[model samples]
Target: MDAQVSINDSQAVLRLGSRFDFKAHREFRDAVESLLGQAGSRNLQVDLAEVTYLDSSALGMLLMLRDKAKATNKDVALVGVKGSVKQVLDIANFSKLFSIA
Candidate 1:
């Protein structure tokens, strides 16, 4: 899995690659960590449109991001999730825990 993190002012966007799993741990965590360093209300968006798969480890990573974001007062959002990836998250009841768009 690969991740690209971009920050604009207080908004940070992390674009995921084809797969989101244990391989993405470092990149994903670093991207979320970037948001924690910013001040004020931060918009941390995880773009999963390009992601074709999401393993259990990926779900765990998302949960970790949520906790870290919450601690720093940053807003966490999952965007562009569709197909199988969306199904996995839905089955996990992550929709209730996160704002999916």
Candidate 2:
């Protein structure tokens, strides 16, 4: 996966592309950390529209981000989820954990 981050006054948007799997761990973490470090960012939106594939490790990573964001009083949402990615997330019950759009 590849992560590109953009931060505004109230939120940080992380646009992810390609396969979001174990190989994405470092990139994902680094992006999340950078977003969380911005004091003005109180919300995080992970854009998965460009992601073509994902595995269990990707789910785990999202969960980890949710936990970390919550600790910092930041809300996390999964945006542009569709296709197989949407199915995987639904099966994992992520809708209950994140605001999906």
Q: Please identify model 2 stretches exceeding 4 Å from their true place.
A: none
**For candidate 2, what is the lDDT?**
0.95
Show model 1 residue runs off by greater than 4 Å. Answer: none
Clash count, one per candidate: 0, 0
Q: Note the residue pairs that clash in candidate 1.
A: none
Q: What's the CA RMSD for each of the models?
A: 1.3, 0.6
Over 1-101, each residue of candidate 2 has an lDDT whose tens digit, in order, gives 68999987898999999999999999999998998898998889999999989999999999999999999999999999999999999999999999999
Index of the highest-TM-score prediction: 2
Candidate 1 on 1-101: residue-level lDDT in tens?
77887788778888988988888788888777766776754788889999998899999999998998888778799999899999999999999999998
Each prediction's TM-score versus the true structure: 0.91, 0.98
